[model samples]
Target: MNYEFTTVGALIGLAVAIILIIKKLQPAYSLILGALIGGIIGSGSLVTTVNTMVSGGEGMISSVLRIMTSGILAGTLIKTGAAEKIAEVIVEKLGEKRALAAISLATMIICAVGVFIDISVITVAPIALAIGKKSGYHKEALLLAMIGGGKAGNIISPNPNTIAVSEAFKVDLTSLMMKNFIPAICAVVVTILLSTMLSKKQGVQVTENDLEQKEDKNLPSFIQAVAGPVVVVILLALRPVASIVIDPLIALPVGGVVCALACGQIKNIREYAEFGLGKVVGVSVLLIGTGTIAGIIKASALQYDVVHILKMANMPAFLLAPIAGILMAGATASTTAGATIGAQTFAGTLIKSGVSALSAGAMVHAGATVIDSLPHGSFFHATGGAAGLEIKERMKLIPYEMCVGLTSTVVAVMTYVI
Candidate 1:
């Protein structure tokens, strides 16, 4: 075999270094360093690489702005007690005996609203942890259940992933939704039931203290506790189904602000406006960084390199689609990317190359969630941290998530294919 310093090899090396830096260095600084190194290695020239690196650096900031904004919005919602209201109100109706059902349904509804996964986790984790503390339930088990339900919403909803896949594959959203709906819904049902049974077997249940306030002194009324945030998120989420006219994005934030005002949570319209703008900051920053990274890789011709490797293999399209999705999921730490961009980009090729559509679709779904389960994922890290799981302990969730993801894919394929 010839020893070739291919562009792909350089990019991979760059990726490895970035991962190392992420673990060690501050996030903002590490991203910059990685992009600079990527430029140098990808171009094989110093001056030209520096120029490109500068451009990439600037672009990354722009992307970060968007992600940061979104994050801030999410953070604000949590701080303002809007998100908590939604969760508690939702759980109150479920009853204690059906806690699993309550948790799953709450997760599903929240996710379907097209909220970011990290935000959703942040919103839900505290409640889940509180429940675990109260019921003597294993925190990990309950966390997994919450994550499972969220993942279901992430995969199947007409959220970013669905739209991304649709744009990439040149397929209709409604059609793909129809195709994948059954398996996605079934996966949530089965996973929740299984998690609940396991929790029960483990003798997990939230105690009265865990479920109720201790002193009840100066405690907000339950209606006051839930009204604002629930109304906002629900109105926003329901915008599409409610009217034939309004844009969902506009509606979501608008509803959030209005609810804030109506609930007397906002002192004035200016505060409401600030809350909306501020809430988007952290999320906007994250999005920008991720988008810039994707852009830099694309600019450096990474996709072509991956495609070239594929050309050498005897892999058919069906397998390739799933495999592509899996890789994308791992790289991006996003199922949304896997379903929308990964599937759209590779699914059709796989189908044309003799892969069954159902199998390809199933693989896309499987790949999307499995990658999220990895310890490297932001979702995993955030949830684990919030729940007080050490890194070593966080590994425990991996096998379960993997098993669920793999099993779900297989079942999906079987449901559609044979």
Candidate 2:
């Protein structure tokens, strides 16, 4: 009876949470609320509900601290002007007249660095806006290019998100990237060409408004900009080396602070310490909240069963991964979540059903890239808000984005299949 009740209630809670998330409610809050309610109803006891709430609160608080640290680190980078300096250096070397092309390059670079899309966006979007405005190009074009770069690059890089998915599904990131490289590269190329052509056809005029959006001049020293974050990244990549001596998580914040100091941006060591704590709290809360939802579903055994059902459907890897991602993107308006989960869920089935690891991986990549072009995506909203892009109004790039992703996936499938 308890099993039946827990299973039934979890399904209900999941549905409620999904609907609320789709309706633009905060997912973390909605999920916890749904879980609490379900727990109470399923257990039919207030004491059990209270106990769960207390534990959940502790977990959420811890996770939120993590998120806040990453956020502050990001915020400080923006405030200290180091992030701007890096973007400026890259843009200057790349040539502003080719801003869209430049964006493609930046995207590839960031992706290869293995940054999560959420963090990557916070790091890159402002820079993309600054560059596009300087180049007198439509922000829309540049932003789309940025998304294209990050989404496809995610597929090719050993980013933690994909690494998590890989671990969850028992896939190897190195092998996956190796197999998926061609399609990912081809997608970036095609995306760049299309963006450039679209920028031309739109015949968008750069007015005075564009010039006003240039980045601030209080940029950090070039060396500070270069060394700060790069060191942390290298540390993460060299996990085998770092893990032999120190914990990677400890190393990341420590490295961030070291870079912050090297950049001469740290006012005090305590401040950096506090900032890291904040990020840990915030990110951990969100992730753990998500993990809780996952836990409840797992406890009920419904989520796994549902996954098996989808797997046994025996759909083509190229089609199923992207389609699932599209549905998730539409629901959550977040390609990060959509693509991450979609890849995890589909990877096993896709591989078992005869899809090469690389081909299947590309399908996941294609889904994220295409869905993000939709006007409803968080990237679209955030970029448009920050950049003031009004080229042919909102969501004008959807059709074009869809075509690019679809075509790119087809190419990826062929490359892997043959």
Query: Over the stretch 22-52, how does candidate 2's per-residue lDDT look in tens digits?
Result: 5767766766666566665554355655455
Name the weakest run of 10 consecutive residues (lDDT summed) in model 1. 63-72
For all candidates in order, the CA lDDT equals 0.55, 0.56
Assess every candidate by TM-score: 0.69, 0.70
Tens-digit lDDT track of model 1 for 1-418: 1112335634664475458534755433444455556655564465655554455445444323333333323433444555556666677787665666677667765665445555676677667767667556676677667777777666654445544454345444434444565666766786676677667554334444434343433323445544444554454334345643333344345544544554465554455456546645533443333333343454555545565677779533345555666665665555653344355445545666676664565567655776655655466788676556678766766776665565556555666456
Candidate 2 worst ten-residue window by lDDT: 59-68
Q: lDDT, candidate 2, residue 132?
A: 63
| Segments of candidate 1 deviating more than 4 angstroms | 1-7, 27-32, 43-80, 133-136, 156-183, 200-249, 266-280, 300-302, 308-314, 318-322, 331-366, 405-418
